[model samples]
Target: MLNLLSGFIGLVALILMIPAVIPLLGALNWLFVPLALLGAFIGMLSSKKGGQNFCLIVAAFGALRLFLGGGII
Candidate 1:
């Protein structure tokens, strides 16, 4: 149940990250990274690794975007 919830949260964050990829919308990734990290934390409470991994990947993307944008684009 927790794993499922985590996955759902990660999915939502990933979807939200779509707009953040736009040239001038990089600031949105600031919101996405935390959300994804929260999902990853929740996933850590579960035994399975899948949800946690998914959330981590989403967070990584957000972090990469932030890095590329120099923390603000």
Candidate 2:
């Protein structure tokens, strides 16, 4: 379902952010952070609580990366 897909994508984005502290990958966090947020939003709209909770956790991770990486103030 769409919820699962969104959560999966968010999870992938969270994984991708793992290396974002490196100079080469730092720029990509700009893209990944938003992608994760979008995925979380999509998943949040799902009727299933499980998917919503999972994606929200992924989104939180992405947000943490964004903040630590200086992508957001």
Candidate 3:
């Protein structure tokens, strides 16, 4: 489905966009948070199954980030 495809693409974009675009452009990370959130939310809301998958993906990512960074969100 398009939802699934879009969500997957968005996730890739969310993860890769900053690392790929920020350094060369001298962009700030603060500006990227909204973009990442928007992409992840829209990507997650595309379909029922995609929503569920996105929820799981978010949880996993959060846990990993928390553990690795050892800080509060």
Top-TM-score structure, candidate number: 1
Clash pairs of candidate 2? none
User: What are the per-residue Cα lDDT tens digits for candidate 1 across 2-71?
Assistant: 8999999999999999999999899999999999999999999999978899999999999999999998
Clashes of 2: 0
Instruction: Give the winner by TM-score: 1 or 2.
Output: 1
Error of 2 at 10 (Å): 1.5
- The C-alpha RMSD of each candidate to the native structure, in angstroms, is 0.5, 2.8, 6.3
Which residues of candidate 3, in runs, are more than 4 Å off?
1-6, 13-36, 55-59
lDDT of 2 at 56: 67
Candidate 1 local lDDT, residue 72: 93
Candidate 2 per-residue C-alpha lDDT over 1-73 given as tens digits, one digit per residue, 9 for 90 to 100: 8788787887787788778766556666777877777786777777775656676676677666666767643
Candidate 3 clashing pairs, residues 3+ apart or interchain: none
lDDT of 3 by residue, 5-72 (tens): 54664465446434533334323333433444555566555655563355345444534443444433
TM-score of each: 0.97, 0.67, 0.34
What ordering of candidates by lDDT runs from best to worst?
1, 2, 3
Query: What lDDT is obtained when candidate 3 is compared to the true structure?
Result: 0.47
